[model samples]
Target: MRKIIFLSLILIGLGVLLSFRPDRKPLSFPSSRVLPASKKDLQYKTHSVKQSVVHTLLIPASSRFLVTPTLSPELSSLESFVQKHQAIAAINGGFFDPENRKSTSYVMLQGVWVADPKDNKRLMNNLKLRPYLKKILNRTEFRRYRCGQTVRYDITLHSEPSPTGCQLLDALGGGPRVLPELTSVQEGFVDFAKGKVIRDPLGSSQPNARSAIGITSDGSLLVVMVAQKPEAPSNSGLSLPALADFMKTQGVEKAMNLDGGSSSCFYYKGKTVYGKINQQGNQVRRELFSVLVIR
Candidate 1:
């Protein structure tokens, strides 16, 4: 039954690919342009956000959320780190649903990685949303950082149930391959998740009070950043549209939304990106049960 569903999704994806015509072509930017350094050189200065229904974006009106990265100025030093951890060579990011558990602050790190499938088993062994430094030190690839995908989309996955418990996918890749786990968990698809080749349509989600993250195959990064509508409205320092627009501006070919809210956050380049914001504001807490860090 799962095989049947998987096949259907591949066909859908193929159809979408075949039906492709760029709505807008993005202006080219140097793909090699590196991000700003973390400056601190090693450790990350932590920040926080009060858990809330709606989350926010990195740069107001920015699609590209920057990570102050872990670095080794010397290749030998970098190689030493890579030897201990996993690593990937493409751009990716987004939120992840728990392996089987669900919650309000459930958004965890998820994205593409460069590692072995056996590593997947190891990662699942310690899968906790928002894991800590020591906890994250597992599955090191060549001593650097393990580069397995935050969200594992193997052939074994099945239907993604809606919030009300209805399966969206009727079929998937047919044989042993798994679908990408494409789902809205539907309140419905938001804006950022939509495609805009040139950033005009720069898709951003409709600002969910809660959300998570995930990555696709198109070399794009998604930040399922969310901001909850409070029981009583107050200053929520986060924003969107600009982030989605920034993503487009950054030349991401495709993007989308995920589960987030207080759960939204990322770790890369040695520094944590925007910290979690729940109801109040930035709240610094470590090890969120489950977090997908890019090694």
Candidate 2:
């Protein structure tokens, strides 16, 4: 009888212990992080080819329209391809050859331009971005834009997910306009189930934690993000050759890397969606250039 009573008490104690344990639904950082895979996670098939550009999705020749703007042709080349609030840049920037670092992103909407759109900035100052983005404009949100050393931008407005810095899409047609070793870039944006965009920081490891979604007018409106390269933090993951192959496997015909390390940024319409490539913040980055824009 004593043994039975003791066993019952032990079981009760265990139940209580488990009930109070912390939940591990969405894994946290510095601990065990986990990214939830959705239907969007595709297992694409590919053929053996060592080409820089390969078609992932069959773009209807009829649908693939080029951009040529009436204003700065360099501003946008996706001539009449975009609908309302649409623009495509030429030669998107990246971390490939600009080690000298002479680029930053700012925003131009309507006739006004906003620079350094950080989420936490003050709104009262006209020289500041918070007012134009959050207060005066009543825009939902912003963030410092994030992208891989390879993922370049096309163009879209009010499409920025975060409220801080604006991301310039299609800045320079497809890739770095000058001093580049690798060429070709893809542009588009995706949404994260309407919650926020996911960033697979090249510097963080919380498996399945990497993601990004954007409305890609450049590629028939599809969300795009490169899987976290196993060694990006080490500055060794997802090389140009490797990316070409990986993108090929995933049906990415033309893709490019964006500013990596601290310069790498991503944000949903209202939040800085995920971590960054280098994990080191981009605050003190000098000659530091970023894109801050609005619709």
RMSD to the true structure for each prediction, in A, is 23.8, 19.8
**lDDT, residue 104, model 1:** 17
lDDT of 1: 0.30
- Cα TM-score per model: 0.30, 0.28
| Best by the lDDT measure | 1
Residues 137-242, candidate 1, lDDT per residue (tens digit)? 2211111111242211211222322223222221111111111322222112222344633221112233323223222344223333333333423444233343
Off by over 4 Å in 1: 1-233, 237-243, 278-281, 284-290
Cα lDDT tens digits, model 2, 40-151, are: 3322222223221111222222342232211221232112222222432211122211332221233332323433233223333436333223322321111122244322
Model 1 error, position 22 (Å): 61
